[model samples]
Target: MRSIQRLVTLGAAAAAVVVLGACSAPSQEPSSATDVPPVPTVAAAGPTTPAVPGSTTAAEVFGPGCASLPTGDDPGSLSSMRLQPVAAAVETNPELTTLNDLIGRANLAGPLNAAPELTVFAPTNDAFAKLPAEQRAALEADPARLATVLEYHVSGTRASAEELRAAGTSTELAGGQVRIGGTGDAMTVSDASGGTANVVCGNVPTGNATVFLIDTVLVPQA
Candidate 1:
């Protein structure tokens, strides 16, 4: 009878241990990555931003409004309008390559960074390269001349292509005049020397300014 009672107690203990082990097993888990919460994927295809309520990308609709204003296929929303912060703004713009190069050469990047509000008419790499070697050399020799020419493209007000077109002459941040005019859909800017630069892609918005992409570089008249 004593042996039988000990055997029964051992059996009960084993059963309880098994029951407790089964109860402590982890609860049902998601089977796959698909079961996880959605995450925004910024793929190589293009930039991806969080979906905004009632916001639209400029790339979705190409128009004159974006032509003169700082425009880009920015990842962020229009409400914020900042594709990148001030420190990184110039680097992100492919069209501003020449301008950036000049800025680097002139060491004006620091002064530009310090400005409160600025509008830049950024020229393509080809535009600067197109200039006569001697003329560019002369401009390089004179920092003031280089700066003045560069500043001609800059305006205090954030002017879109539409705004620039509407107002023929916009007062530049550097206290010079930037003229605007064109017959067809493509707008042209007449420099102080009556030379015109056609708009390639306009209105690329940055944190501090809008960039109007120009096919030709605007030479400052001294």
Candidate 2:
């Protein structure tokens, strides 16, 4: 009986060892998880400004002659000129009297006022007055010839001083072209005949056009 009891106790001990082994997990090294790459960061862009169209560049009105123009509601003033069409605006400025008369003689007043957009390289009264009397009278006598000459001073599209510089050349309504050279007050407009003119007043806005008062009259190519 003592031998049988000892055998039974040994069997229980063996069973307990098996149960403990089964309940506990086997010793194992921790798993090394995959190393995920970090997401890339992006930066935002800055805002872009739009370019102005034609003479509407609205950049600024400047030039030596700008100082002489009247201020406020006077039609000749830059502010007031902006309110009138090209032809009507021309009538208000004393300096533009000769130009206005030439426009009438050329039968261009109607066309000028009707234009949707334009850039006029207008000669000051002195420019016209400086011409030989005979030549001026001859030009005035022939309206058709005067029209061509007047149209030569006009560009189909409006351009500011900087715009003219950027383009290097401008096409005229008369089918001719002018070469632009220099910057600001030094800027020069050279015709096909080699005649060059300097802009006195620039960025003078009309309801439908921009005018640059030049010191010399430009002629188209023959």
For residues 24-111, write the lDDT of model 1, one tens digit per residue.
9988677796897556888676576324321223443233433433333453323234555332566555545567767766666755
Worst lDDT 10-window in candidate 1: 49-58
Q: What is the lDDT of residue 175 in candidate 2?
A: 75
- lDDT at position 26, candidate 2: 83
Candidate number with greatest TM-score: 2
- lDDT, candidate 2, residue 19? 97
State every prediction's TM-score relative to the real structure: 0.61, 0.74
Q: Alpha carbon lDDT of residue 51, candidate 1?
A: 44
lDDT of 2 by residue, 97-180 (tens): 999998888778877776667788889898898899999999999988888888888886778778898999999877779999
